[model samples]
Target: MTGTDTPEWPRCGHTDSGERCRGRTVAAYPACLAHLDGTERTAYLASLTPGADLDHRGTPFTQSLLDELLAPLREPGSGRVRVGEAAFDEVRFTGDAELEGIDFGGFCSFASAVFDGGLYVQDACVGGDLRLSAAQVAGDAWFDDTEVKADAWFFKARIEGALRFCVRRIGGSAMFKGMMCGDAYFSGARMAGVTSFSEAVVDGEAAFDGVHFEQGADFTKTRIAGRACFDGARFLVNSARFDGADIGGDMPFTGACFEAEASFEETAIGGDLSFSGAQLAAGVDFRRAVFRRTARIGPLICPGRVDLSGAVFEAAVTLEAAAREVRCRQTRWARTAALRLRYARVDLSDAVLEFPVTVVGRSRPFVSPEGGVMAEPGLTGSRVRVTSVKGVDAAYLVLADVDLTGCLFVGTVHLDQLRLEGRCLLASPPPGPRWIRRRTLAEEQHWRAIRYGGGWTPAPSGVETYGPGVLAPVYRQLRKALEDGRNEPGAADFYYGEMEMRRHDAAVSRGERTLLRLYWVLSGYGLRAVRALTWLVLAMTATVLAMMLWGLPQAAPDPVSAGTADGRRITLTTTKPEPVNPEGSYAKRLSSARLEKSMRVVANSVIFRASGQDLTTTGTYMEMTARLIEPALLALAVLAVRSRVKR
Candidate 1:
């Protein structure tokens, strides 16, 4: 038989285009030499020698031959297949290529190898480097539960179906750079070495859920057309980088733990990027990253710095951290983007927030994009809680629109020179008052608390707190910001705060400092008109009482002795009206008249006017003091009222 027949004979089962081979088989064989059972098959089977350069290009592999080829690798530490240059290019498998549990002893290359079916390498051990670069896989590439002792490279490889490496342990570097494949699964995989997927393109979803990386991982320039997940993945040490990655779908990192530095710099995300319940122990960099959708990172434990400089959040960006160590510096939010930091302890010392920063509370009007009347935004819409904001730089820091009603500011903040679209609200909401007739004990207590103080104390001293004079700058800036926003009432409040701070600062001149304190004590630094009026009334009343107690001087008829020329004088006594008893009712009426005149004199002195009654000061010093103080009180009251009105 020449292995070529048209009669009733078995032909080679292997064909590139599914055309039956014309070559006949040997005795009792089902296929020709190319498939099996011929001189060529025998030579090919015998060529599978140990410790040799296995060149299997343009050849076909049967299950039995593959078994025999890997039989040596199956022995535990006994035999090695050291193919110095593994050439399996364009090789085909007649059946499923099962290389499971086979240990590769040296560098292996299957570049451009074609798998007609799935490639199963479950629990396989690569003793040295393994390269499947540019290999074309028709079915799933299963490397689950395998161990790669040396570098594992799949650069530029194309897998038409799913590629799984779940639960596999890679000891050395695992690189899939520039790989274009279907769904890529690496869930529960443990990589003790560097894992790189730079410039890779995945057509289907890419999952690395619960994977553990002992070293750094790089996914720079990767593009995922489907959903990408790293949920519960742990980066134990070194850096985990995802720079310049483009994710078309959701990229959730829920419950992920990063023990070292983690970076997503310059990445572009199309869907929601979530990190809820994630634990970040080291520094995280998201500089220049672009989020097309919302980026929610809440209820996380981040003890390290989170650099978000130059990052663009197209939608809302919500972050809630348990630790205040997270810093948001120079992060950019789009005009439509809403930033919420609920129940978080964070630092926005140098953060820049764009305009239209509205929250849920009081209603403020805003025109819709369709050019129609829309309900005003609310103040308490979303809450952003922070431990401190030391020196924040905002594009438009409209405190009114930047609803901080839900925020608890424990640190001193600087609000300087930022554009204001509306009012800036910083004061607490006013409590309702009770009418005098309907007030109860509880109502009275509430009123007392409001009138006296709320029992608030200064925040603890830390980096967020500035020393004595340092707060003056903050108040100054805040006043300027309020004035710029055209909130004169709010500006006046902050101006008083600024002046009060300067009064306490040692840097101020002694005279100015003393004057400020006096102003505050007398009339609340010209801010309390009621207090100024009360002091004026009290001073006038005291002067009136004193003048009443000490009677005014009555100019008696000037010495009534008729004086002659200087040499000799003759006395002519003037006739006196009938004398009255001093203790009699008439005498008492005269004394009352004197007292009334004294009261008028006191009132005239206080008003800075001459008394109509001819009354002289019985207590000259007291009168002079009254004259000086009454005018001062009047001036203070006028100034206080003017301030209240101007504000």
Candidate 2:
């Protein structure tokens, strides 16, 4: 359908006739829709393309003269401008006018040009490169839904007002380096190749919602005074960098991905930052970046490290469902909300975690059997909650002055030195699982004797302080028990017996012995034996003195004697003095008379001190005295007393 074949469209008074028209009137008097008489049409078209002049000097560039172009289209009518089948390859727009919906049919270049008013190319299609490099737009520019067939270069362009490129797709590279826009919107735009906005400055919001970068993209050093949202964007190729960019508002990158390294190093974000569900094939570095509000990188996966070293989050930094091996070196979080790193494998080696921060992990079943390993020392001035860490080799693993009151390790927990003020449970073998039974003391001793050749040190002080000292004693007892057995028991039985003996020894050491006969005997008569020996010696000395005094005549004799008192009665006493010896003599003379009489008494005392054989002998003697001699003496003393009473 050609313009000429149609019927005559309504024409306004601004229409021109004859050769002055740029081309044949398309069955319409007013060749361009902007020349319509309505004020609304004029105003709307004025917003589309500013600085439009119909004539230059005395020559007409279009159908309407320059004076006629100045007149505004009146209200109650739609204003439109159509550039159909036109080759404005190098056209320069210099005046303030309107050219809405103007189509540039082929390659277009307004390079190094200036436009005093707004330029609207809404729904326009450029067949080739659209070079607006170094162009100056004094009013708001609208390129909404515009398609650039070839590479579009707007490098060093200055737009005094807002620039809109909403829903536009560029088939080739879109370079906007050093371009200054009052506000920019390229929402839902698809760039087939690289899109470079390096060093561009947007005074207002720059919205790139649902934008697709088919290849690489770079926004390095771009400054945006307003929000820079690339929500739901995808970078298909590598080398996607927004490094050193400064954003005045929130930079939400929800559901974004970078196939290669995503570098945001040194970027400053004035508002909240979000990168939910973002995936980076390589490392993502936000090192030394500053976020003015909450920055979230949740549910993201980076196959390589995610470095946030020296990055300052003015608010909380949340990292949920993070990938393995995240490096959060020297990150400073200003808000009270802890930087959550749940469900992540974090390598905070050499990291300085400040106070009011919490490093936590997900509460899930043990996914890794080996558990988490620390490659280096981790310093935590803040609290770290690691719940359900299964299969840890050490529960106090290299912890230094860390307050672990709330930390939980529900599986096999290991430690180096854990000074826990609160309670901590050691990981035990799970119930219903195959458990390796603990070795018995006998088994341990046998093993030790065989393996180490019966050499061992005493248990450490800490162990002795905390528990009963039984290891050595148990070991000895196990050796003795095994030696006494004719045949060695099986390993299991030996181990069981050894353990029982160990327990027994522990009890004995704790003074739980059933028979204390040896102790009782040693304590009871230990001093009494010495005292009895001393008394026996004293008695023997007294007896000796008595015998000596009786055997020997007294040195001092009594003064009065029986026959010496009166001498006058001596003659009568001599006749009655017959000796006892005379009776024996008379009996002997009669016949060989025989007579005999005998009386005997013996006293014995013995004391002995010895060990082993000699001790046995002394013990036997003491027992005999206790069981027989002592009792017999008591009976004898009783009988003697009874006989004396009878007498």
Candidate 3:
């Protein structure tokens, strides 16, 4: 075993079955790259110290060993070399070497090998598939400016240091399943085929900015502990899915275009999601993506659909200044936050927006932006529940078939300035009873009065006219009139009733009518006329009674004389005097006529004694005369008195 005696060291050839010698020199280490089996190679490499070197002091190495190590990479005709067999402390492949571009055929193992210096593969191409699964590098691993013409599989490979692929291009598919890297940069890399990183964990930031994917791209279940940016990257063919990928920092897809479908379903992004200028040709499905912080998709244009169903934003989901048609079906936005849709055209038909969806400020909870006009005919069947809805100034907004049943609006629901072109039913449909009944006479009158005065004019100062009780029906009729251009009798009837009612009201106000016209008409006028006539009759009767009393006898009878004798004798005398007519001519005429009409004379005699007049009457005669003149004179006196009183 002495050095001078040259103890028999292991030969460079197979010392046992399935082994080869692969080291810079003999006596350096027995477990070199070429002397072990696949399993042994991995185990040996894992046992090395970090930053360990492969070449120790060289001894007398056999010529055969040098030739095996220094042989040029075999041509395409020759089969590929299975390079790494035994584990080494470190495996260093340096110098200006040109490996075969297409010869490698089987699995290449470099698992857990630490390269202390840079492993440069600049401008070199690997024609056959390269497998570096579970390989770890301590120093800088340069795949920069390189091309893998075949499918490159690097599953579970761990690069402890910076891994740069600054301008590398992969012609075929690049699979990096469960790959862990410290800080990886694929700044301008182009993957002509599918590039997948399913479940790969990156401890540091991974930048794929400005990278182009000709086929599809997938990062499903990938955990990026640092920022993972696909900013300005283009996915030309199929989808770029990031479903279940956890991004610990800001994941920006700014200026990226998904030519096909793009998905971020169930992906948990810890920081902001800035897709500010991304263009999505196909559908962008973000169902169930949890944004732990702010999520911004502002200024993005998706020609196809964008589904954000079941996506949760912990902070604000700002879509300010975006022009895409956002489909947010059943999205849950958090409190004290906003889902700003400022200056964006949102098609939320059939969307289920959760409560407290703020549009502008944090306090004001709504979906429409402040000072922003919503495009009409947009949100036909959407259900949005918010504390308030404001700042809508769009004309012809069609909310016809929308179901906003759960919306609870507080404060004033102002439609004062809103120009509703069509029949816009509010979330709460108008109460039915108001519109069910036909217009009453009073209602008709009101409508007519208003129309005559110019419909719906503001009242004069200090006057406010309340709206009609049946506003729904009124509005409906107006809408029909405007739309159909047909005149109905109902309108005219209403106008008539309105005028009549107004006139009656005015009469009542002026104290001109004791009763309303309707009441007066219902009761017959006979009672009023009878009341007036009764008063006149009573007055005339009083005048007649007064005249009778004034003309009645005021003096007592002149005398009745009674003479009493010793033997009870009595005498009575009566004196009668003036003529009936005062006028002398009428008296003469009456006397002459009385004489001409002379009547009969009668004589009477009394046997009993007593008064002088009685004794005279026993031997006297009495004359009777007809006297129409006296009666006429009496009637004239009465008539004269009556005429004087009348005057």
Candidate 4:
């Protein structure tokens, strides 16, 4: 009821719409019921009984009156205060409200409840839940510091400012689902039960730094328009999921620890996703996650596996961590930027990596059935890059099943220590004999025995079946790679391998093969200069031994003139044995000098050297054969030396 402006009793001095209220005061009160003082607040509150239907809506109560009104709710076994649809429209609370353990019978709403101070509701046991849906608070909401027993529901609740929660024990599930709010600080808060924010849109920064989820944290389909940080947060129990979450800004998960399964499947991140230093005890599935920008996942410690299959990244994505196993099958690393792995130990068994990708560091050993523990990692079907790879661990790389049919290599393709257990298919099928050599029936049976048996078998084919069939192409590529790197020694090794394969080719004629094998056995395919020199020494010794076997040739004794009875003189050849002299004799001395000259001539001729001495010609086929043999050996030796020096 409106009172006169100048009434005998004091009217409400509270201003509304820039004007004072015209309502009269209560009995013995200075102001109206809407604006009562603290001294008269108790008298007004005492008038109501325990079961009284209080309808103090729109009334401005002092801090003392509000405390006394809610005093009964703080006690145990106190009946519910039936404030039927009590409205607290635009109510300004001045002091900290300790409304713990408050029971409301009906839908009690403080829609526009403005708190100038903080709201402390520790261990609040409410029979009817405090559905403060769409409630507005001015100060921080402290539902945590004290163990809140209420199922904290903040559906569509808007805080005009910021809020923080402590490590409070929640009795039931706390849902901030679909709540539109400002900055939220959830540092060190442990929600002991189920927590959900499905479809909730946070307009300001949501910092869950160091927060622990004892159960599950479901943020499925949630949208965060600002920065969302979960740094150092721990998910101890159920799955920590952010499936289909759309993050508008950066989401830094640095140092976060997850004990259970964590999934970010189908999540769309507009900014960078940083998981640096994150520790995972269980597996994390990021399948189909779309990163609009870069993702830096490094310095991480994950003992469990990580599945990132089908993930797509628009920008660069680098993995610089150590984990037990990483599966990225069919993951699209980037659209344009490089996907570089530094110090990562990944098992890219069936992965499809985009071009311009590089890997550097040691990985798990690649085991082969035929060849025992091959300490290498395999990139089975990934595309080879020309300029991306640098300083990779070539010693432990496995490219057995890799196909380099169309790959163009610009730099060194180090395959010296590569494991090629599978068929080393380098190029496509060309127009040539499918099998390296003709496999006879006996050869085939022998190969089958080698395949099934434990030990080696003797094959009918001159060359072993697995000797050079698939290794030819591999040797070619290896030679090219080593040559590009300017490693001449390594290149020469592969070159020898290539030559050996050609020499063993069944298409090669027997004559050519005989020549090639002869050279190979004698001098290491003409690449070993020492072998040629050793053969030369043996040839010289053999020549000297043959000379010793046959007596030294003395120039045909000068035709001797015998005294003829007639005037004509006749030449006589002496075939008589001369007596041997113990010391010096003219015939013996002449024989020794001739032997020395003949030995020197034979030695020089065998080594393809010119000798000044000329021996008397003995017209015999043996002499001609000896001359041809020495020249041929000399030519082979020269070729061997040339090949080694040029190589």
CA deviation > 4 Å runs, candidate 1: 1-37, 43-107, 116-118, 337-355, 358-492, 497-524, 528-551, 555-614, 617-647
Evaluation by lDDT, superior candidate among 3 and 4:
4
* RMSD (CA, Å), each prediction: 13.0, 23.3, 26.9, 13.3
What are the Cα lDDT values of the candidates? 0.62, 0.50, 0.47, 0.55
**Can you give the lDDT of residue 367 in candidate 1?**
29
Error of 4 at 532 (Å): 6.3
Ranking by TM-score: 1, 4, 2, 3
Q: Say which prediction, candidate 2 or candidate 3, comes out ahead on TM-score.
A: 2
Per-residue CA lDDT of model 2 for 554-641, tens digit only, reads 1222233234435565522233221122222332323211110000001222222221111122323443343333333334334433
Better candidate by TM-score, 1 or 4: 1
For 1-647, candidate 3 gives per-residue lDDT tens digits of: 11123223333344446533323233334544455457664554555432222232112223233234324333335443223222222233332222332222232334333344444444444544555666666555667555666677777777777777764677788888898877888898888878999998888898999999999889999998889888899999788989999988888887687788888899988887666656666667778888887556544445455567677777655554332345555566662344443223343323333333433311121223233332322123222222112222212122322222222111112222212222222222123632212233223323434555433223334322333333333334333432332333323323322333444443345443444343223211111222223433343333223212221112222454445455676555565432122223433433432322221111111112211221112112211110222222233344433322431
- Residues 1-647, candidate 1, lDDT per residue (tens digit)? 11232434344466768665554453355565456646755655565455554544444666776665555433346543333345454456665677654555666666666677778876656667777887878888888677777888898888888888874677788889999888999999888888889999999899999998888689999999889999999988788899999998898887787878889899988887666656676767878888887556443445566666777778765543333234455666674443333222344555556544432222322223355433211112232334334445444443333333223322334456644344333434235542111111121222234445553223333423333375556556756875776665556655666666678778889999999988877877776677778988888777665555543443332434444565585656675332221233434434666566667777777775757443334546567787888778778888767755664
lDDT of 2: 0.50
Clashes of 3: 6
> What is the model-wide C-alpha lDDT for candidate 1?
0.62
C-alpha lDDT of residue 132 in model 1: 82
My TM-score estimates for the predictions, one after another, are 0.62, 0.47, 0.45, 0.54
Question: Measured by TM-score, how close is model 2 to the native structure?
Answer: 0.47
How do these models rank on lDDT, best leading? Answer: 1, 4, 2, 3
